[model samples]
Target: MKKTLMILLATILVMLTGCGTENKSGGLEISKDVAFGEKDYEKIVSPANELGFKLLKEVEADENNNIFISPTSLFMALAMVYNGAEGETKEEIAQVLHSEGIDPEELNKANASMMSVLNKEADDIQLNIANSIWLNDKFTFQKDFAGSNKDYFNAEIAEIDIADSKSPEQINNWVKEATNDKIEKIVDSPLDANLVAVLINAIYFKGSWTNEFDKNETEDRPFQLLDGSFKDVPLMAMKEKFSYLENEKFQAITLPYGDGEMSMKVFLPKENSSLEEFKTLLTHENWTAWQKEFEVEKGTILLPKFQLEFEASLKGALKSLGMKSAFDENANFTKMINEDDQVSITNVKQKTFIDVGEKGTEAAAVTGIEMGITSAPINEPFRMEVNRPFFFTITDEETDTILFMGSISNPVQAK
Candidate 1:
């Protein structure tokens, strides 16, 4: 759970084109250029970094050892909204999916069929909630097999039931299972299940620190928080060469994962800095420019070891970014999920948990189970000394997008 507060902020939806073959239906078709632009993806990742988190890595894969989100989460979340949406909002959704080269009609039909079974089974559940505020109706989805697995999060199903299904419970079960009994319930108050969205990313990552801090040399340290408070933190002190970056915006440090390929970068604002002001200046362009400054150099690195927890509704944040139409009850979503009944997207609730230690990293996230991978071996020693007040981030080795970001000011109360 501590890892989540620091890792939950990084994410990017990729643009995937020509995933598979041509369309069989006369409906809209997604093209080969359907992925989100690199710049846009980066835009989402940078802030998480500035906010004080670490992005480990992000990839698409399926396996038991890997993390998995029930396909029902995606299906159910969308269905709830579809049950409430109508006109222009719906059309816009369809257009986005269609422009991506997906068959809007086909996806809608599939969603409708699934909704029928779900609605019938949960007849006692009231679903009058409007979705125009969450999703547009016109949104279309790619229909090809390749299209199914092209997005950052997998939307297709391998084996599952839509109706007469007990997906809501499954979501809860997944939470317990992933957290090892630590997080017993991700969604409290079943009656308050206003909306749900689930996303799962499982990875086995190992990276060595640029400079290994001697465990015997570790000691207690102080970490500062945005509230002007400080706490005793375990500091891993080391002096070695590493990829470091310093600029007017912030002073940055990089801590490599178990393998030297991926690293976690920490950015510390100058003392007496306005945390809010520093955050506002964060952007994709600045991150790009700053990253280029990373170079190996010798210096004293003090990092604090701590765990933290935080929860907030992202609907408003996402809406401020131009995704409003999809949440309106009167929106058009015919291009996305088509059923004989009205449809739209309602709420988007996400819960994340993570644990990072000297051994490895484990994390779980849900977008809407009602809605919603792996690699590698390490032969070299990963050297990272995290023992002071600092911000960290994780990123894909190939794409610089921040996968997760957060701070370790007061490790004890972070959760």
Candidate 2:
């Protein structure tokens, strides 16, 4: 076999990683999405999109994580941090984000464009992206640093006193609002006193599949696990002409939502193939090509009606993506604040919400890069029953931007 990254690590990580926790439920209205023109957006998104594969591969290698992440949320949060970084700290992050040759100015412009296209409102689709930077009022912040983020990234600059008892509630409230209450408590109480800043990116998405599945057809079906055992999961069955692809290795399909500008693509390994073996075939190139390979074919697709809230510190996974010094104590973040303030990334964490049902899909993710610390496919005509572990992605069809990516290893926990 090539290389195997256990695919069910997501299940394990959800338990170990401080993932989804609800604290006061509600949504908060933010400024608005920024549009600097979609000109260079693809330049940055395309390369950074490569990190998704690297992450899954990392999860595979670690084999102790629940596989779910928001590529847009994670990268955009880092992009905010990148602007505040100087020298080697900047260089290392650039390489990890795959924007080594691109100018920071151009990359910033591209990111603005990417956010604009993905966060825009569409018929039958509600996609919202919120970015913000929280600073300790006790310290002085660099204006140029904050302005670049506000103007280019459209981030909300909030100066909150960390010493206050209500700090976590204050920040988590914004997170709840940004994600439509899907993610309620990303900021835990007892704020790290050493935390000088908190940079956040929240994405909330709710879309109905163009062809909704009939609820009557939904039934509990046997879903095989990696351990050669099985569990019952509610599988919503639908038969229609779906953009699908079938090859020797896997069966795939693209189920469009709203006006077809976005979709949820699923890839299920063939009965003879395992997810571990199938993961070796994953690459950014293959994902790009797989989206184009789908031909509208007739078949039945049975997907589980499941929901999960996951959160985890991404330090290790990011390190595997070629990032280092950013997490170092002596890391360079002078541009973010004064050198005496001395802040490097103390923690980098993300909390995600994923749900798929007969109505459609509601997916959200919040990526927090602690500055306080310094921080597809388808083919169906052949019955594509996701009766086992499989991978899925909520994507922007127009831009091919992935909002949320995940794998369902054990649907027993799924609703």
lDDT of each: 0.38, 0.67
Give the runs in model 1 whose Cα sits over 4 Å from its true position.
1-212, 356-362, 369-415
The local distance difference test score of model 1 is: 0.38
Model 1 alpha-carbon miss at residue 317, Å = 1.1
Tens-digit lDDT track of model 1 for 60-111 = 2223112222223323333223322345554443332222232433443443
What's the TM-score of each model vs. the native?
0.50, 0.77
The true-structure Cα RMSD of candidate 2 reads: 18.7
Please name the candidate that would achieve the greatest TM-score relative to the true structure. 2
Measured over all alpha carbons after superposition, the RMSD of each candidate to the real structure, in angstroms, is: 22.6, 18.7
Q: Against the true structure, whose lDDT is highest?
A: 2
List the candidate 2 regions with Cα displacement exceeding 4 Å. Answer: 1-35, 60-66, 371-415
